[model samples]
Every structure is written in C-alpha cells, then in structure tokens.
Target: MTLLGPAEIRELAASLGVRPTKQLGQNFVHDPNTVRRIVRAAELTGDDVALEVGPGLGSLTLGLLEEAAKVCAVEIDPVLAKALPDTVRRFAPEHAGKLHVIEGDALRVDVDEQPTALVANLPYNVAVPVVLHLLATLPSLRKGLVMVQKEVADRLVAGPGSRVYGVPSVKLAWYATSKLAGKVPPSVFWPVPNVDSGLVAFTRREPPQEDRNEPSQEDRKATFAVVDAAFAQRRKTLRAALAGWAGGPDVAERILRAADVDPGARGEQLTVRDFTRIASQRQSQAPHG
Candidate 1:
C-alpha cells in the first residue's frame, strides 16, 4: 500500500479545503517512517479488526489497512470522513473493501463489532479519556499502540509512586498494561505541534480478581469514586481527602485502617488494588444486614 507523504498530504488537504484545526487537535502525520513505525508497533495480525480514532486524512488508515483484516476508522470531521473512502480507493484500491468509516465522536461512537486491536494518532486534547472509553467499551481489544502527546504518554504508563502517577495511570492500569514504545519528532506532522509525540503500547489484561469473594460493578464504581475524591484534594492525606466520599473524616480513617492502608498516605501512593480494598471496606461498613 502507498503511504501518504508531505506532497500527497498537502495536495489532498488543499483539494478538500482542509486546514488542521487547533480545536480538533489535528496535526496530520506526513512522515512515512512514522506511520510505518506506528503500524509495526501495533503488532496487528491477519485476524485482527482494528479500530482507529481521528484518522485525519487517512495516513494511518492506509497503513492500518495493510496489516489488519478490517480497519474501522472513526472520524469526527465530516470533510475528512467523506474524503477518506475515496482516498483509500485511489491509493489502495485492493484494500478498499477492508475499510469502514464512521463519522462521529470517538467517545460516543457505538462500535457494533468488537475490534481485536486499536491503532490511532489520537487527538491530544482528549487522548486519555478516549483510550479509557474504547478499552471499556470493547472487550475484544487484546492489544494496540497509540501515538499521543509525550506528557500524556508518560502519565498513561506511569506506575504507583511515580511523580506523574495519578488518575490516568491508575484508571488505565485497571484495564491494560502500558509502556512508552517510542518517540516521534515534531517534524513529522503537517502543522508541527510544539511538543514531541510518544507511542504508548498496551495489552489488555483481566481486572484484578477477588480471591474469596467476587468484586461487583458497584465495587468498581465505589473504587473509582474513592480515586476521584482522593485526587480531587491531592494535597490532603487519605483520611482528610476522602472525607466527603467516605461520609466523614472519622469514617474515612476507619475505612483506610480496615484496608490496612495508612490514613496519612496521599492518593498518588495507592494502586488501583488499594483503592479497591478501600471501596470494599466502605461497602462492608455500610448499615446493612
């Protein structure tokens, strides 16, 4: 398949009257090497059905079509969405049948068929939420690679106790294991972003299992609530930070103690499992029976 270069990209954009918009975070990738690297890092197999978000100008989409059995691209912009199919037909006619385009918001798009892998140059502004949402919505996504802003990449792959560890890190850990695969220079994009981009590669894993009792959906909700509340006041210790979430400071202390976590510890120090334990304690202490 022919990949889009600087000339072809510019020509297509000019034809469609498309200019990269800051609001959409549209920095189109024009480097052939960058697109090839992203596709290789994704590790797509012949059986894989890939879901690509914000496929601006079909650069990555063309690369994905080369590897994946089917490429379902979700684009928010109507012009690019309409132009993508014809571009594919012109550039990679043999693979045209493998391409499916969905014109809508990635966050709200309903994917009827579960994609075996995800590959995208995600919009920098909404990268974290979009990744988290797709992982939660599609159970069959076993693995994938995404190119995002460098700082966001660090946060997504950050582990407990790391300086950047917080909400994105913990929540992402609840679904998949992630690592920084590589970095892309700013020169690769059409409207070069000020900051570099990093590739975050991830493999989905089962949620932590309960040894004796099964954790329910309510347990997940309660744990996420604790996570949000704890980070909402990052400066405060767990006992004080979770006061409103756990009903009060005293009750929060008891819950922390029951979970065998130190009440003085801050939210950044706790893992998703620790938060789950705190949630379990809260549920147990509730007036029931």
Candidate 2:
C-alpha cells in the first residue's frame, strides 16, 4: 500500500469493490503529508496506546501503527476492517499485532478503558458526540487528537463570548484544554466533504478543580435538569426556561450565587464549572425525594 495516497486509495477502492460510504461519514484522507502531520501532532511513544475510529482504507491506521505502541482501530464496515491487516502489513509488517482492526461501530465501543492516547480522523457525524462520549465516560484515556469539522473544532476551543461558545465548548473546556491545531482543506479528502476540516488537540489538564467532585445525588438530577432546561431554550433566561424542571429554579439560583452567575443569564453564559457547581448545590438543598 505504501502510504495509500489518493491514487492508490482510489485504485484500491476499485479493486476492492467498494466506494466511500456517506452513511458512515467515510472521507478517506488521500494526502500522506496530512497523514504524517496528524502522526507528528500525536507525539506517540512506546507507552502510548492509540484509539482510532474510522481508519478508512487503513491509511491513518498504518501511520498510527508505525508510531504508537498499540493502535486499536474501530471501523464500522466489516469489509473495511477485513481489508486493514493486509493493507497495514505493506507499510508496517512488523506491527501486524500492533494494529487491532475491530469490525464494529465506534459509537458502541468503550475506548476510555484502553488507557492510551485517543486519536482519530473522526467520522463527521459522530465527531462531537464521539469526543464527548470518550471524555465523559472514559476518564482513563488521557489525551485526544482528532480531525473534525472545522466549525466543531472552533466550538471546542471557543471563548466565552464567541458564537461557538455553548454546551460543547463548556464541556470540552471542563474535560481538557482544547486547541485548534491545524485546518484540513476539503481538497485533501477523496470525496471531498462540503465543509473544511480542522485538527483538534485535547490534552488533559492537571490539578483537577475541587469544585467538580462528581455531582452529588441531588445535584446529579438537578444539574442535568438545569442543563436540559436552559439549552432547551438557549435564548431564554434560566428562570424562564427552567421553570418547569424540579429544583431548577432553586438550583439555578444557588448555582448562580455560588459561581457568581447571573440568575437572568442564559445557558450560554454559564461555564462547565458553573453547571457542575449548580449540580452539587442541588444535592445539598434537596437530599430527599
């Protein structure tokens, strides 16, 4: 395969009797430089285990296998998964065992338990939710470098007042210190996606904030209730939007007081810590029922 550039990728697709699946958001990278760039960005080591999703045609998987100690690649299509090992052997025969091509849906896989560097050219459809899923559920995985929709990358690292600042932004900031590493032009893809792509780096931050001690029982219910309520109507103020949810008014008020958030503020105005603090208070104020 020798890096599987676009010409090789296109020819391989023809020989393999397959086409890129739009349903799966399968936009294979045809540029080796982009491939190497993503590898360099990861800065892998023998200790690093990489979790890659949608390693279409095994191009990125080939690159990852060469760099990381272990690479677990989850591809939804069984056909693609079957083609991966032989494809990988062409570039990294020594890493046949190092590359794990799991034929399954990435959304269903639990990658956090792997305890490695999580990186991928994430399928566009699952990009944000996938990152959120891994970070939220798999605290074991330390860092992530993913190529995502440029707009999404922007939101993940957006400032408080920026248009991109919202739930994703707050959530990303709470989980990791995110940055827009680089922009990937549409031309780099085989069947170019209408939108441009960007590389996002999410490195774990140390010295965890004491405020996030895992939402207490009451807070757990209240925090989510508040989040759902506020975002239900982002344009609406907390009190107005959350009037229907239990303890939402009370929780929102106390959270605002503790976090110095405004009662009249909308959900967009609150940070991840603000929401986290609000949840804790909910448990304190309403321990029963």
Candidate 3:
C-alpha cells in the first residue's frame, strides 16, 4: 500500500481544490513513517473495526486500513468524504472494500457498525468534546489512540492534583485509563501546525462507583454536573464552588461531608470516585418527588 508523502499530499489537495483550513483543524499528516507509527501505537487486532474522525485527505485512514478489519471514517467535509473511497481504491485497492465513509460531524454522527477501537488525527479545536461524545455514545469502543494537540493530551491523561488536571481528566477517568503515548513533530504535516501534537492512548473500563451495579445514564449525567460545578471556579473550595449546584453553601458543605469529602478541598484535589460519591450524596439528600 502506498502511504501519502509530503508531495503526494499537496498534489492531491491541489487537485481536489482543498486548502488546509484552520477552521476545520485540517493539518493533514504527510509523513509515511508517522502514519505507520500511529497505527502501530493503536495496537489494533484483525478483528477490530476502527472508528476514525476528521480523516482529512485519507492519510491516516490508509494506515488504519492496513491493520483494522474494517474502518468507518467520519469526515465533516463533503468533498473529502466523497473522495476518500477513491483515494483508498487508488492507494490500497485490495483494502478499498474495507473502508466505510460517513459524512457527518463526529460529535453528532451515529455510527451503524460497531467499532471496537477509535484511531484518528483529530481536529485540535473539537478534540476533547469529540472524544468524550464518542466514548459516551459508543460503548463498543473498547480502546483508542488519537492524535491531538500536546496541551490537550496532557489534560486528558493528567492525574488528580496535577496542575493540568480538571474536567477532562476527571471525565475521561470515568470511562477509561489514558496515557500520553508519544509526541509528534510539527514538520510531519502538509501545512505544518504551529504547536506539536501528542498521541493519547486509552482503554475503556467500568465507570467509577462504589457498588458493582452498572452505572445508569442518569448517574453519569449527575456525576458530570458535579464535575462541571467543581471546576467552574478552580480557586474556590468545594463548599463555595459547588454551592450553585448543591443549592447553597450550607447544603453543599453538608453533601460534601456526607460523601466523606473535605469541604475545604479544591476540585483539583479530588478523584472521579470522589466526584461520584458527592453526586450520589446530593441525590440521596434531595427530596423525592
């Protein structure tokens, strides 16, 4: 299979009248070695059906096709989505039948085929929201390796108490364990991005909760509300930060105490489990209708 190199990438884009747009976060990967490295890091099995988002110019898509049993690519751009099948046919004719292109926003697209893994060169602007939305909606996604902005990567994998840790870290922790896989240089892209990129690798796990019971959608929604509230004002203690969410400062303190959390603690100091516990306490204390 012929992977797209720098010249081929520019040539193809020019032929298609496609200019990489910052609005779409369209810095297309042009290095064949980088593509191979990303695919290798993903560790997909032959049985795995991969879900790729923002597959601009079919660079990483071709690499994913090499390993994954099936690839469902969601492209927001109509032109790119329509052209990907042809690109695959020309570059990897044998694997053309394995490619499925869905034309829609990754955040809102409902994929028909059950994809076991997510592997993509995500647009930097919507990377976090896209990842969170997919993980929430696609329960079949057991693992993933995504390339995103370096700063966003750190936030995704950051631990509690880490300076970068906040909503992304706690929310992602509810779904899976993530780590920084590797860093990519800016020179690997067609319209080289100013900032470096980083690979984030994650594997799905059960949501954090005290009991063995399966977490309901309501439970997750409730926990996330608490997470949002806690980090809304990072400098404030839980008692003050969560006051709006819990109704009042006194009520917020009561809920925190009930959850066995310190009211004086800041949101950055707590884990996903702590947040879940606080959500549960708030629910228990609320008057049932």
Q: Which number leads on TM-score?
A: 3
Q: After superposition, how far is residue 263 of candidate 3 from its true place, in Å?
A: 0.3
> Which lDDT tens digits does candidate 2 get at residues 1-289?
3677888899778878879888999899989989999999987888898988888787788788888888988888888889888787767788888877778887686553375788899988889888877766665678889999999889888866677687677666766888889999999898999999999988876422436454343443455565666678878787667555534566556555665667798887776667766555545564333
Arrange candidates by TM-score, highest first: which order? 3, 1, 2
| lDDT tens readout by residue for model 1, 1-289 | 7999999999999999999999999999999989999999999999999999999999999999999999999999999999999999999999999999999999998987689999999999999999999987788889989999999999999988899999999888888898999999999999989999999999998776444656556766677888999999899999999888877888889989999999999999998899988888888785322
TM-score of each: 0.97, 0.89, 0.98
The whole-model lDDT of each prediction reads: 0.91, 0.77, 0.95
Off by over 4 Å in 1: 211-215, 287-289
Of 2 and 3, the candidate ranking higher by TM-score: 3
